[model samples]
Target: MKFTHTIKAAALVGIAGTVALMSGCAMSQSGDLNGMKGGGHEYLLTVTRPNQLHVIDTETNKIVRSCDVPGTFGQGTVEPSPDGRIAYVGTNKWEDVVGFDITNCDIVFSAKQSYDNVTVKSFVSLAVSRDGKELYTVQNPTRKLNDRYEVMEPQLAVYDTSAGLNAKPIRTFPVDRQITKIMAMDTGEVILAGNDVQAINPENGDIRILTLLQNWKRGDSWTQPDAFAMHTLGEQADEFILPYFTIKWNGDPGDMEKAEFWWGMSRVDLKTGEVEQGEILPFEFIVFNFITDPTDSNILYGAFNTLSKHDIREKKTLAVHNMEHTYYDLNMTQNRTIYVGGTSSDISIHDPDTLEKIGSIKLPGDQSTSAMRIAFLK
Candidate 1:
């Protein structure tokens, strides 16, 4: 079985004048979408400002379905089920999580991380186990009792996906503050990325620090690493690739170059909890997110105001291309074609070898913002 573009749905969500005619087929069992092979529907799921989710067909470059997600405040990240059938998003002002059945364009699961009495916020990244049995996210919570509010410790919240909508966190384990990303490893362990990476046992909630960023030794004045890309790369399915930048402040206010900062990535091994890094370089530009070519780990691609391809071996940017607008997410095709989106209405596609803009897909609507991350389903 291989990934294909087959739109087989047992159910379909009908929105008046929106989401055009989709076949009214019986919905497939909510299972591992990554397992389904042959011709199946492949989509680029994007979430916009004020809680709107647009599902665009990657092949057709058209909006096949769009839905206004209720209760979602700021734009959050979208994580797809293993089968790619459902997209789970952390919304409702990053205080709630919802699972939307992309085929039907309806929510199938919802969990609120925060409430009036208990305020909680998930930092926009969610992880689903490869088995699709558990969902994990770092929850920052606060409890309000009487007139005073208690800031509770952040915890790793786990939900059983099979529990369906309204699935409450079955278990929560204490996690460190400033945790930016959560990833379910191939070994039934969850990786929490922040100041340092940690591997946690899903069954017993035991956590161990996998690696430290300071080991790279760029400088002592480095800031916390912001790992925006949580998904594992294809080449290193058992590893997590985190691209982050560190800022430094020098006494010379006029010397901007001295304070230019540095950027690099930490390639973490999920099973053994090991980490490795390449050369570190100055922050030439702003990169909100980045991805490495699984086929060629030496080549790293970054996205923001410009799309850049840096050769880790060479320790310099191989090429840079101006984008129509800044991007928040970056991914590549099987053959290495690049897909950059998240900031404006469309996704920009570029050649992997040359970093040349070959094509672009303009999404439906005016001023639509792509979700924090884009899911490319085969």
Candidate 2:
């Protein structure tokens, strides 16, 4: 339980820039994104402020490419294409979405579409479905609702990318009701969670509710109002949850016990709108993205914003990666762990299984990008 802030300035990047995995040698510089994959892996990363995207070779953990986004990152969202060949970013900079071909490291398309009303404020969230046919962006941006505090509720806009580049959103809705997680079923039913599996048909604005638990406990039983957060997962059956993971002070239960929180990670079923059956994490986790076990409902993996794992059958949290502000996104397969999108100018590395800080990652510049959208190219 000790804290040290010795390293100062951008030079910190050089420290964690060295990475060595079971696959090969690791070395990465700034403007590079290293995605996790089997054998050989790489990622084209986009970051906020000073606007740019970096391509990192996972095998070498080194930057192979860096591209300028002009004045974009603050307002645009970047998402990888279905095939992993292209990166798509949508920005309010104008009324268009820019598509970058990662293989060549350049912009290929600037698809333009018109909207009657525009906030013009850049805060955004990007999401790509399992099949990559449906793309979603938070039109209102993920900001603090309290203007005085930085909280906000952004609208979810669904787009049909399977069609033309200018294809429009087939659905748009807010997630605040009984729903805690919202994702597409690819079957025209939107998944939501809360007291039940709620589905909203964007076309007619009709409602469908599926009960996940007959004797469901109220949200207040385990969650606080301010702890509001949500996400969508698993297209096969459509699953979601209201996240309730956080650090609890070490002490005996009772008045002496104290707990403070800032995040939660939950997933819901798009088909049933019911929160899929699963055990809640023993501790709270604040992750931007989490992957569900494609085969089982209990096995779940996500970044606690510091790397984490959980087992539904045992109802336990596997202590892995003691990353302090170094978690971003996660990808899971069978029993493999793949993490991506992290920022901490200084070097930060931990065991993928224990989460112990094995070392740190130092970036080349202070220009660290916060990933707004991401996905494994399957």
Candidate 3:
């Protein structure tokens, strides 16, 4: 049964109750699950400018399909399904999590974050379990009533992936505000990283503060860490890396020479709950984003006016490669092909080992990428 979902704002209460019930139980549908097993090879999906998702052929560097996501556009992250057949896109304007089918270039699922007077947007961070049973997200909300807007509390929401299209969250638990990112660990604890890192038990909404940067003396006179890169070491790797940068107050904030910027990285061992964070770079220009080399944790690559290859142990850049423009999203494919995209309509490919320019894939329609992911389609 197809649901058009056109309802009056006055009926929100009734719809909320209905959604709660449906969230627990998903009515099974008869459709093609064969594709769920995967057949296609490597493909790239980029959330582009002005509300678009461009699917590219990684081998040929050609756009095979451009998926249209109406009414949304922003710099956010994309989470690929375990099977790599679908892509979950995070967008604030639409206030919904859209799952796009890369094979067919269609929207297979959409979970709306808001209805009626209530509006909620997930903070770029979206996660699907390795078993593919659950979807985890942190939602910041706003409510409108009597023609006035009121900021609401943020919450951690979990959805049953099997729960068909447009499924509401099965459960939502109140969490502290200003959480920017969340990653579900194999231990069933969701790591919420914002001002601080926390390990939260999603089942009961119990939060345990793992560390306080201020107390630990991680940095003196620094800025907030940006936890945007969602790269992992497949299902076999044990360590997780978090990258960010901070500005230090030298003298006057306006004096560039007096003030210094530093790049930092945190390496976390999931099983042991051990975290080691240190300043990786003494000076930073414009390292907008970075990703740790899954194969070698000592190495990391970041994008900006120049591509920087850093030695995590030495806390310095091993090599630097200039770019045409600054990029935001950076990732390495399973085959070890590095891609940098975000600031332009094209994705620049490079050899991860040599840092040499491999080639470039110009996307169709001249759209700039906000978030791009390298997916292996079985």
Candidate 4:
């Protein structure tokens, strides 16, 4: 039977109410079920305002559990362990990293980045190793003096995940400024996105530029590309992809009216350690974030005020669906269902083929720049 939009909305409300009522139940009940081996379920992980880490079961479109996280929430960036058991979050106003055991909602690991009169902040930079043994974040510190504020050089802080509670950086290395995203590759190399896409050796602090983004010499007709790397949604596709924008002079370089805006993507393969980037499409609309299809690398989905599907090789957009509001993050499950969340409490789900909104998962409060990530539980 075909259900109307009104009917589906009503049914979703009913399910949400039931889940809310079940919220008071013991955590162990759901923990035991999620802890079972070979469960093979995909769960959505995100944080909402007022300090909450929500785990939504994708199959039922219901939030199974909302765990309480320590410290205040700010730029809520969550990095789930490779095993999907622990979630490392950047909270406490971006001054600390806290790892929560999703199975029991226990605070397993915590690292305070700031100490003394020096204030440190990691803006959306958090990543866990594939083996789940090491956690990495780039910390920008500023020392407040009696009369002046001194800005210190940024450093990459590495923490051992097993260092439960009050974890400190086991090793620190200097890195470039403006790095907002970090990802651990299978080869034990860490990738940083900022002024340029760079790969750094975590063991020795050696760094090499994989792609020249802001400093790219794409001829005199093209301006410097601008891109921001905030969301970590590469796990599903096993590749870290970032979209960038640049303007090209159509005719005379001195003429401003003939400028053509373009959008491109810089990608790093997590498995093969290969780096490649190129223009995907001429700018038609704005996209806050993008996620590549797990099954097909050529296909891409973008989210913001609209949901768009694109073919990178063809440099064409296959479909575009206008959204009700803006979303800052985009992710997909193994089944290819696209999930868009940010700037609101609800996570909107869409059909991969039609690009149509199929369902929505309502959260407890506003997401407020939080990252929405997918994790598989087994």
Per-candidate TM equals: 0.79, 0.57, 0.79, 0.90
RMSD in Å for candidate 3, one decimal?
6.0
- What are the per-residue Cα lDDT tens digits for candidate 3 across 26-61? 221233433332354667778766677877777777
Candidate 2 — what's its lDDT?
A: 0.46
lDDT string, candidate 2, 61-104, tens digits:
45556666544444335666545545666553624555555544
Q: What is the lDDT of residue 352 in candidate 1?
A: 81
Clashes of each: 16, 50, 0, 0
Best by TM-score: 4
Which tens-of-lDDT digit does each residue in 70-167 have in candidate 1?
78554456777666666787777778887776766666667877766898887755888877778888889989899898999999888987555557
> What overall lDDT goes with each candidate model?
0.68, 0.46, 0.68, 0.86
| Model 1 lDDT, residue 286, Cα | 85
Residue 271 deviation, candidate 2, in Å?
8.5
Ranking by lDDT: 4, 3, 1, 2
C-alpha RMSD of candidate 2? 13.6
* Model 3 TM: 0.79
| Superior by TM-score: candidate 1 or candidate 4 | 4
